[model samples]
Target chain A: MSNRGPADTPPSEYEDEGRERLSYVVGLVLALLLTTGAFAVVWLDLLSGGAALAALGLLALVQAVVHLRYFLHIDLARSHRDDLLLILFTVLILLIMVSGTIWILYDQHIRMMA
Target chain B: MTLRGIVGLLAAAVPGTASAGSFLEPAGPIASAQFSHFGVISALMLIVIVPMFVALPIVLYRYRRGGKGTYRPDWEFNWGLEVVIWGIPVALALALGMALWKHTLEYDPYRALGPEPLVVEVVALDWKFLFLYPEQGVATINLLALPEDRPVTLRLTSGTVMQSFIIPRLAGQIYAMAGMQTQLNLLASETGDFIGRNTQYNGLGFATQSFTTRVMSPDAFAGWAEATKAQPAALDAAGFAKLLSPSVVSEPVLYGRFTPGLFGQVMARFAPAMVQGHGQAGMAAPPAPHQGHHHMPEAGR
Candidate 1:
């Protein structure tokens, strides 16, 4: 809508600063780096089993943060609280569903007679 | 027929198998515990279903066909009814979940049941069950006999596709997978013959893939084990290959002896081909560990 900001600055100057094109490109490059690093570690056999899994998990967490901060523009500011709250709720529900499914199925897998 | 006669008929009809195909007629310790769990869960589920079944008829009769059962057009929501509707199922689910959690840990498959439980390695082939008693150096087709009162652990794998090993009176089914091992621990409480089979279908012969489990006393078992050593059939690699040729074993087979460590090799035989899919051509597998063990008794061969 209106490209208006602080009275001290003109609208055109403020719009250029707030566009965040540089931040998004940086986020995209970082996400690709994390993904490629994880894949290379596995492909090159740098780590095996649990170590490789943990490394990939760490990289994925960082990439997710990059997406939220740069692409989705989520922040701690009061103006973005509603969107942040929705994301938090979605994550909570997702964690509950995935964990509950794993708990039930893994329990069956371990306890069933073979 | 009289009640006693009917009961007698039912018992005899299922002879050489457990009394029932369901856990209700459990013949072993594991199955008995599972049967109890089934009963508990069933009752908990009825907490939801039974009330609905009873209420449906009463509500229909009272409200329909001009039957007057005190009309309350102004009624909205009753606090007591609301609490009853939601509270009961939630309470039942919590109770059932706790029970499941406790028993699940208690009956974990990998836990060893006793100090010296008999180990039976099972391979589910096309339409038959091949049970190898590694410790005894014996193998059987379509027959699994064990000593009563001793815990038995079955290390199960599949030679072909996946199948489920189930002995209804003994324990619930667990899957048998190729190229991997799974475990089941159970113990017979009393001497009885029970039915065990592959519960998952693979091919045309799947329907008849049943086997018999005879639980004899320790003395009888020792005798049977000794007698098995003289069964005239030696379960060498060639004999085993013949066994793998996809035929239904209509009768029980006994191999007086099996090559030591044969079970491990049988498990390994699937690995390379499964991984490579080269039609087992010139795979050049090294001699199996059991094949090396054969020199212990026969010095010349």
Candidate 2:
């Protein structure tokens, strides 16, 4: 009943698989770079507390996108629309829960600090 | 009366029999703001909930066999109706989420609402609350005293397992984790006592872990502090050590002196090596933890 083609298709499918492997390798290297950048900032103590936090958060977000795009194969391609929408919805729910918990908890920390 | 009417009446009567846990009956600006948020959420929810409840009977009766409702067997879908159905909830949720975000910032406990708030260092033990008024050089077990209309800041952490500190009438709850610090800022709009408790479960003595909050005038608070300072049970290292015995404190006990950095020492107990020479010197600075930077392994994925 689904529109998905069979897993064992022709030479075209094999070409797609080869390209997928290349993207994975590229994503892994990029992820490493981002992670190292975040560590370098922290280990070197180049930035203050809030700046370091912001830098790390931004790097982490970019790293997440790298993983989703290359590793998970989520993209703006028409064929990926349904799966991307599902993943985006999942991300939306996670953003709500995680951000809400942090806001509610950390706000208290700010108010109560001596 | 219908079942709904009966339920409403029963809910109305609940206030008479209870000790009070109504966020609706807030006592301060924080609680009042929270209550407004609650109002918006409930009203929005009712826009969804009330329709579902009402439409159930209407749909069942109308669409039942041989009913007068217009039949549209050939229709697979209605684009306009579908758009409205999906769009309304999405729009509502987006708007509500933004409001929550705004309020979260506006009511940030760390934002310093007014003048320097009275700092009350709260240590959540297994079965009781140990409060230290560092400025007043006084401590109390299971009793909190705050001056009315003045912002009071609570810097809280757990000596035992993770717990949450909440005074339902005054402000929202925040977790008190072992080896980590959390905070809550609150104030009493009136002179009265409210119930505060550890909403987190931590082994056997969890049920008994609650405290009495007495909000008094400035003069009354000063009087209470002076009278508490004269109490015999001084909060030296030994007194604080005795508090960790894993038993419920039946009544509030006052201490003349609380050891400096006592709250930090309690947190450091869970991470002994993390707090090196400070604990031994009997004067550890309060827990202001810097989060560690760690990387996720690619292989794990």
On a 0 to 1 TM-score scale, where does candidate 1 land against the true structure?
Answer: 0.73
lDDT digits (tens) for residues A36-104 of candidate 1: 998999899988655666787788889899898889777777346788889899999988897777665
Q: Per-residue lDDT of B1-301 in model 2, one digit per residue for the tens?
A: 2433444456577765246544556678888778777766766777678878999999999988898889988988889989988998998898889988999999976555578899898888878898999889999989999999888988787877788888887898998877666668887897888888989888888888889988899999999999988887777778778777798888988888877878767766664543443222211111224322211111011
Best candidate (score: TM-score): 1
Candidate 1 lDDT by residue in tens digits, B155-179: 8888888999998878878888776
TM-score of chain A of each: 0.79, 0.74
Q: Lowest-lDDT window of 10 residues in candidate 1 chain A? A: A105-114
DockQ of each: 0.10, 0.06
Off by over 4 Å in 1: A1-18, A22-59, A72-114, B1-22, B70-75, B272-301
Candidate 2: which stretches are off by over 4 Å?
A: A1-114, B1-18, B271-301
Q: Rate the local accuracy (lDDT) of all candidates.
A: 0.76, 0.76
